[model samples]
Target: MKLLIEGGRRLQGRVRISGAKNSALVLIAASAISGGEVILDNVPKISDVLTQLEIVRAIGGRASWTGENTLCLDWSGPLEGELPYVHAKKLRASNLFLGALAARQKRVKIPLPGGCNIGSRPMDLHLKGFHLLGYQVSMKHGFIEARAGKIEGNRIYLDFPSVGATENIMMAAAGTPGITVIENAAREPEIVDLAGFLNAMGGRVRGAGTDVIKIEGVSEFRGARFSVIPDRIEAGTYLIAAGISGGEVTVENVITRHLQPVIAKLQDVGLDVAAGEDRITVRRRGDLLPTDVKTLPYPGFPTDLQSPMMALLSLARGTSIIVENVFENRFQVADELKRMGAKIRVKGQTAVIEGVERLYGTQVRATDLRAGAALLLAGLAAGGVTEILQAELIARGYEKVVEKLGALGAAVRVAGDESGEPGAKSV
Candidate 1:
């Protein structure tokens, strides 16, 4: 469905952020390995998470809603033949199942994952991690097929800090015999949350949210109640929404430290940010100024925010250079921003942006989840009406985006293409 956003209003409201998408995806995949039932709380009603859950059930796992924001999973049943690739290609998170399914079923076949046109995120690390755990991995017919007689724990070292690889190795090691140690592990909070959920289900895991992680394999696993951490990315998006729109907004249900990089960048752009126990407030008193930024792993400027920051920087007072060191193809949104009258140029991995006094609203398409958000923010801050297409991409990660923006006083609504009726409403 498409979205029509009328700009020229500063959004102001208290928005309670939902659970982390980065954490919830891996947590759901990890829960499938536990022999008993697993209950997840505070889960976001996102399309990608639902797709992952569908994949889990397609593999013979039983899933049911326990509450408005809770789901119960049972993964002890017999394995299905193969995962449906058409559904898997809808999002990249589907690749996470390679490790979980391989460990549980001993043999698994899944399609090559797809999501966001950001860049090429290879599965080499995931494949290598599985090989370390005594699995034979290969790709054929555009699918990843993995087989193992029995998973055996071993030392695995990741060349780069990859969140997907870390989660894959963690899931594979849960049922293997002996102990597995992963060096140079990803330090993202999502990794720790996944470990916490696995531990609650009788899996022995330690040292997450750090460079080193250790997992002790067990013969069987059970389940328990798990609550996902608040989404820092969502909080950061809301903070940006308030910043560029020149509004005062408070975002709740989040860990302040998780958003240090984002808060720092906002402050650099001349926005006032106040962090309390479990909430953050962003207020812009004057015009924003451009600030140079580089995308890195955790504790550094996240690559996920690169697109949105570009939108904010478009209205800055000076020129800003943003170097994307993580994903090679993350600058896909640069073209879409250009449609909205923003000046941006991409040279290889670096993006040089020139600040414009104001941007005029126009039609654009969302290339990815964060890119969709960046466009929406630009539309809200731009002059006149802005139409954003392929808005369903936003729902893959964030929950109730339009509704939240409406509550914050932004004139945003969904509309049909030729038909006047909008798509089905969802939170």
Candidate 2:
């Protein structure tokens, strides 16, 4: 599918934030180890979430949506030990089942995961953690096989604070027989949400939002109910959308504390940013100020929002520098932005962008999930019409982007069916 956007439209209104996609995936994977029904509220109906649920169903589990934003998963049946390649090949989060399945069935055979071609996202840390838990891990014929008579808890330290490794280790260790202490664990808000879900199911976990997380193994997990946190990346993207379009937009249902770094960066760029208890309002004050950004872990500038911020910085009055520290190929959007007449130079992990007076619209392709969002924001701020190809990448993360942009008064719509020519149109 493609997105057709008419540029130069001021987006002004209030839009409610959806649940975090990162949190929803981990929560759904954690449901596989539950003993009863797991009910999750405020879940985003994105393609990634649906794909993860399909993997669960393929393993003899049942998942269904009871409401628009609510999901009920029943995994009490006898689940299969091997994860099918057909379902596991669609998403990166499919690797999360390694730990859940190992904990439940004590044996797992899953294909090497696939997602956006962003960079070398290795699964070494995850495999190492599994080995430490007494699982015999092997890889051959493009599949990972792990088997163990029993999962034993032990102290494991990650060389880097990887979010997937932390979540997988925590889930696998939840059903073991001893204490598992994870050093240098990821401190993202999604990690905290997963810990909360496990705890609600009678799992003992401590220090989730900190670097060191300790989990005591339990014999079983009961069904539990939990709500996901608001998506900070989506909130940051919409806030930058308001800045790029020179409009005022209020985003509600967000946790203010989770966006301090993003709010600080927007303030540094001379945007009018205000935060209340659970909402934030952003408006373009005047000419934007050029700023430098470096992507880091949580409590710092997020790597997920770096691309969208680059789109807004393209229209600033001075030169801006961006250093992407997370993913090596994250700057793939720079070439797409250059297609729209923006001055951007990328060398290795750094990008030098010289602000231009205005950007002319052109056809661009989305390289990844966040890159898709960056292209959309640039299209909204460009001078003419812009058509975005491979917009399915955006739907994997963002929920109802066309409908949300419309509610905020932007002229954007999805064009072309699976058998039609790609095109754009104004709504």
Candidate 3:
């Protein structure tokens, strides 16, 4: 599918942020460790979530949505340890099941997971953690097979603080026989949410939001209810959209603390930002100031919001520089932005963007999830009409994106089909 956007519309309204996709995926995978009804609230109905739910069902677990944004997963039945290639090859979160399955059934066979072609997201850390837990890991015919007679808890240190690796190890260790200490663990809020879910499932976990996390093994799990955190990246994207369109927008249902770095950068770029208890109001007063940004882990500028910030910086009054430290191919959106008459030069992980007076809309392609969102923001800020191809990539992350933008009064709509023609309703 494609998105047809008539540019130069000022977006003005309140937008409620959806639940964090990152948090929800890990929670869904963690549900496999328990054999009861687990209720997840504030879950976004996105493609990625649906894909994860499908995987849950394929593994003999029952998952259904009881409300518009709530999911109920029942893992009371016997689950199949093997994950088919067709199911695992669609999303990166499939790798999360490795830990949960090994903990539950002592074996798992899953293919190498796939997602956006951003960079090399190797599963070595996940596999290494499994091996440390006494699992025999092997690869044959593009599938990973792991078997363990007993899961033993041990102290494992990750070379890098990888979020996926941290969540996998934490979940796998929740059912071991002893205590597991993970040093250099990821400190993202999503990891904290995973720890919270595990704890609610009768698992003992401590120091979740810190670099060192300790988990004591448990013999069984009980179903629990939990609510996912709001998506900070989505809130940041909307805030940047307001800046790019020179409009006023209020993003609601967000934890402002999770967006400190983004808020700081937006203010540095001369945007008027005010944070309330659960909402953030953003307004653009005059010309925007150019700024430099470097993506980092939690408590720093997030890599997920880097592309959207680049879109806003493309229209700044001066030059701006962005260094992507997380993903090597994250700057793929630079070429798409250049297609819209923006001056951007990318060399390796660094991008030099010279602010243009105005951007003219043109046909562009969505390279990845966040990159697709950046293109949409660029389209809204451009002078003429913009057609974005492969908008499905955007839907994988953003929930009802066209509808959300339309609610905020942006002149954007999904194409009727792949022909790039606008319709009365969005996809």
Candidate 4:
């Protein structure tokens, strides 16, 4: 489907955010290792999370919805075989099950994972962590097959605190025979949520929100019900949308502290930002001021918001410099923004954006999830209609994006000339 974002009006409304993508992804991995029924609440219905549920079912597991945002996963059935290649290549999160599968069956075969073309997100860290835990891994043809003599817990230090690798190793070490200590771990709040869910399932995990983590091995664990936290990234996106469109928007069902960096940045750009309990309100009255931003890990400006922030800074009064320290190829959206009459130049990891009075609408393709969001936001600020192709990328992350934008008074719609079912143009 294609999305057309009509620009030049202030967005005005309240938006409710769904469960976090980062937390839900790791929770899927946690559920794969549970012994009984695993109940997960407040989970978003985004394509990536659905892909994870499909992956679980493909592995001979059963998943049923108790509510719109609640799912129960029962893995009592035998895992017929490894994850199918067709499903495995759908998203990068598919690779996370390797550690869980290896812990469960002692052997697993999975195809190379695929996802957005944001950058070269290699799995070396995950593979290395698995190796440290007594798993003998090999790649043959296009599948990765791993066999563990027995999962032996040991000290695993990640060279970088990669979130994916951290969750993979934690799930694998949960059922192992000894203590597993992971240093230099990711301190994201999602990591804490995963640890909480695992602990509720009778697994011993501690220090999740710290740089160091300790996991004591247990023979097995039973499933329990858990509620996921709100998506802070989505909250930040709408907050920026409210700022750029000169609108007053209230974002509800969010953890206000998690958005400190983004909120601070918006306030720095002269937008009125206020937080109340679980909601945040952003308002814009005048031209956005120029600000410099650098992306970092948790507690820092998130790398996920860098691209959209670039779009927001495009309307600043002066040149804005954005340095991406997390992902190398995240600047793919720069070209797409430039297509819409935006002035942006990239040199290595830093992008220099020159503010412009106005941006004209144009056709652009969403290269990745966040890039798709950035393009859509840019379209909302442009003068005329903007056609965005590859909207499936946006669906991977944002749930009901067009609906959310429309609720905020943006003239957004899904339209394409391709032949399909009727009303397929406005989904």
**Candidate with best TM-score:** 3
* Superposed Cα deviation of residue 141, candidate 1 (Å): 1.7
- Candidate 3's displacement at residue 48, Å, is 0.4
| lDDT, residue 153, candidate 3 | 94
Which pairs clash in the backbone of model 2?
none
Candidate 3: give the clashing pairs.
none
Cα deviation of 102, candidate 2, in Å? 1.8
Compare the candidates by lDDT and give the number of the best one.
3
Q: What lDDT does each candidate get?
A: 0.87, 0.90, 0.91, 0.87
- Worst-scoring 10-residue span by lDDT in model 2: 418-427
Q: Give me the displacement of residue 420 in model 4, in angstroms.
A: 19
Give the per-residue lDDT digits (tens) of candidate 1, residues 206-235.
999889999998777777889999999989
The full ranking of all candidates by TM-score, starting with the best, is 3, 2, 1, 4
| C-alpha positional error of residue 85 in candidate 1 after TM-score superposition, expressed in Å | 1.0
Per-residue lDDT over 1-427 for candidate 3, one digit per residue giving the tens place of the 0 to 100 score = 8788988988899999999999999899998998889999999999999999889999999999999999999999999988877878889999899888877788888889999999999989988888898888998788888988567999999998999999989988998889899999999999999999999999999999999999999998999999999998889999999999999999999999999899999999999999998999999989989999999989779999999989999999999999999999999999999999999999888999999999988999999999999999999999989999998899888887777888888888776644433334544
User: What does the lDDT read for residue 364 in candidate 3?
Assistant: 96
- Candidate 1 vs candidate 3, lDDT winner: 3
| Whole-model alpha-carbon lDDT for candidate 3 | 0.91
How many residue pairs clash (N, CA or C atoms closer than 3 angstroms) in each of the candidate models, in the order given? 0, 0, 0, 0
Off by over 4 Å in 1: 416-427
